[model samples]
Target: MIIGVVLLLVFFLVNISIGSVYIPIPQLIHGLLGADLDKASWETILFLYRIPKAITAVLVGISLSVSGLQMQTFFRNPLAGPYVLGISSGAGLGVAIMIMGGSALGITFSSSSNYMTWGIWGIIISGSLGAILVLLLMSLTAWKIKDSMTLLIIGLMFGSASGAVVSVLSYFGNAEDLKLFTIWSMGSLGGISGTQLEILSIICFIGIIPVIALLKSYNAMLMGERYATSMGVNIKSLRWAMILSTGLLAGSATAFCGPIAFIGIAVPHLARMIFRTGDHRILFPASALIGSCFLLISDAISQIPGSAETLPINVITSLFGAPLVIWLILKRNLSSEF
Candidate 1:
């Protein structure tokens, strides 16, 4: 745990310091302390852009990783995740509606108008509602069905349905609106403003409470539903709590940073490999720290280090995570650790 935390901090500082224009440690400290620097641009870049982006990377990492851990524990399926379960697709649908649907109806949503202040809230609320809606449906299905594999199939169906709807909306949308949604879907950590970062932080914090509270329940559920029920775990209530927590975490990340892929699925397994345990008490914090570090590293790489041009965050993460997913599938041993 201590090692994970230390790495997370180190990478976070590296993320903040090693942008296009590298700021040395002494100058970085001076700028952070509000001391006048040789270049005013250094202070502006450090304070206004890099800091918030780094913070966003941290929150995104922690939220997605922890949420993935919860899903893997609750569903007891190696392939299950926010994207697989349709939560991200649902959030993407909400964003599509807000951007494409609103534009179709002659409504303007941008940072230039008076509605600018409320725009982020609108996206976040719509995304959360969309994710919760899918989660509730999945919960209902889980209640009626006793098979985890069945629930996994149902979740994939939901993702497909939502994706179709989004595609239709995109077809009817204007070129400019399509471009905006396209950029958002690519997933950029650098796009979050200071105000949006505050909102994302608060939502992620609230989302994590339910995760922390259910650590014991998660450990119980790991042994299978029958065993968990034998141990007096309220399986139904636990399902609701997890779905709600995941909705807030995954949905808010999608709303602010677009639908990030693979981290939610890959990070828990990475944590397990690092920690060498199945205990939720240990896995939770380990996943959070490792997830943050991984995303920070991805963010740093995406910046192209020393270049003004940058790659999309999703591209970097997918490059790292996609092969792991393939390996897991080929190995067919997702349940080995559990």
Candidate 2:
């Protein structure tokens, strides 16, 4: 965990230094410290752009990784995650409704290309509601079904249903709305600044508190429900606690940055691989740090390190994260980890 935190701080600095004009370590630190820098533009770039983007990457990393860890623990399935279990898709559905279908329903937010351009809270609220709706349904389903695979399939069904709704909305949307939604879907960590950054920080902070509180419960849940019950763990309350945490974490990520793929499912396994343990007390913080580093790495690569042109952050995550996860699964037999 100490190593992970140190690595995260290193990556945060590295990511801030890597944009169109590479700011060397000295200049980056000087600018961040409010000291006079060689280039005036460097300060503007650091304060206005790179800093917020880097912070967003960290928040996203923490949110997705921690939430993913909780889901894996609760489901007792290595493959389960917020995205895998349809939480992100549900959040995406809510954003989709606001972006593509809202005008149809008399909602009058801006159609600007900027992500959630009209306001900060609108997308966050919609996305949270959407994610909570799906989680509520999944909780109800889990009560009737103890089989993890069965629950996973039901989650996939919910994802498919949400995707179908999004498609229908897209089909009817005009060219402008379609284009805006398209950009939003291709997640970018840029343009989250000012009040947006603070609000996102608050959202993620709220989500993480429960994870910290439930550490002991998560460790017990690993042995099995009957064992956990015998240990005096309230399985029902524990399940809902995880649900609340995951909804805020995953929902906020999707709302603020769009649909980020692979990190949620991949990071917990990565934590387990590094630590070689299923203990949430160890895994949770490790996953958060590693996930932040992973996304910051992704963000750096998306900037391409030098050129002004940038790739979509979502594309970078999928391109790198998918193959990494596949190799991990095949090499380690990830199912055994959980």
Candidate 3:
């Protein structure tokens, strides 16, 4: 626990310390401690932009990791992740609808109002609606089907459906809106603001608290459904709670971060490999810490060296995560009896 906490802090510091402009640690700390801000452009950049960006990275990391771990535990599939299942696709679909359609719907904004607030809420509402819709469809087939692989296929189909809609929406959108949408889809941690960050914190903690509170049930769940029932777990109710939690974490992160890829799926594997246990108690928090570290590192790299330009956070994550995922699959296949 101490190691995890320390790593979280280290990564967070790195995230805050490095950006398009360089701000020394001492100066950054002084500013954070309310010192006079009378220095270089880097100081202003650090206090105003990089700090918020880093915080967003931490929150996004926690949300995606927790969501990924829960989905893996719920499905009993090591490969299950928010990105893989298309939950982010739902969130993407939601974001596309809002940024593209908001003008037509007269959801115009004043320069004085918080645009981040509107964007965050729009993503949450749209993403949650899409995620819940998919969940409901999955629930309808839950009792009638017992095949995990088949269920995975259904989830993929739902995700593809959401993606198809997003493509069509893009097709008819004006060039300006399409450019905006494309940039958003590339993703970043810099987009979230202070107020919006608080909202995300509240929603993500509300969802994750229940899953942590039900640790014993999740442990039992890992032992298999029949065994879990033998031990008096309320299988049906538990399923709903897990689904709700996944939606809240996955949807909110997706809404804000613009569909970050791989951390949800990748972090859990890293956690498991480190802890060498299937225990959710240890795995949950471990995943959160590792997930945060992974994203912070990615964000740090996204800030190009000696240049004012930075790559998208999403692009960096995929570059790292995709290879890890491929390696895991190949390792699993090599050991499989089939």
Clashes of each: 0, 0, 0
Q: 68-187, model 3: which lDDT tens digit per residue?
A: 887777777777886655667777777777766665565532222535566556655665676666666667755566655576677788789988988887886767667767877888
- Candidate 3 stretches with Cα past 4 Å from truth are 37-43, 101-153, 324-338
Displacement of residue 71 (Cα, Å) in model 2 is 0.8
Rank the models by TM-score, top first: 2, 1, 3
lDDT of 3: 0.76
Of the two candidates 2 and 3, the one with more favorable lDDT, higher being better, is 2
> TM-score: which candidate is best?
2
- Which residue pairs collide, candidate 3? none
TM-score of 2: 0.90
List of clashing residue pairs for candidate 1 = none
Give lDDT tens digits, candidate 2, residues 1-338. Answer: 77778888889999999989999988887776778989888888989999999999999999998988888888787778877668878987887888778767765454544444655466666776778788788888878876656767888899999999999999988777677668778887887898889988998999999899989999998998789889999887787677678878987898888888778988999999879998888898899999999999999999987699999998999999989878977888777776
Note the Cα lDDT for every prediction shown. 0.83, 0.84, 0.76
- What would the TM-score be for candidate 3 when compared with the true structure? 0.84
Candidate 3, poorest ten consecutive residues by summed lDDT: 107-116
Best by lDDT: 2
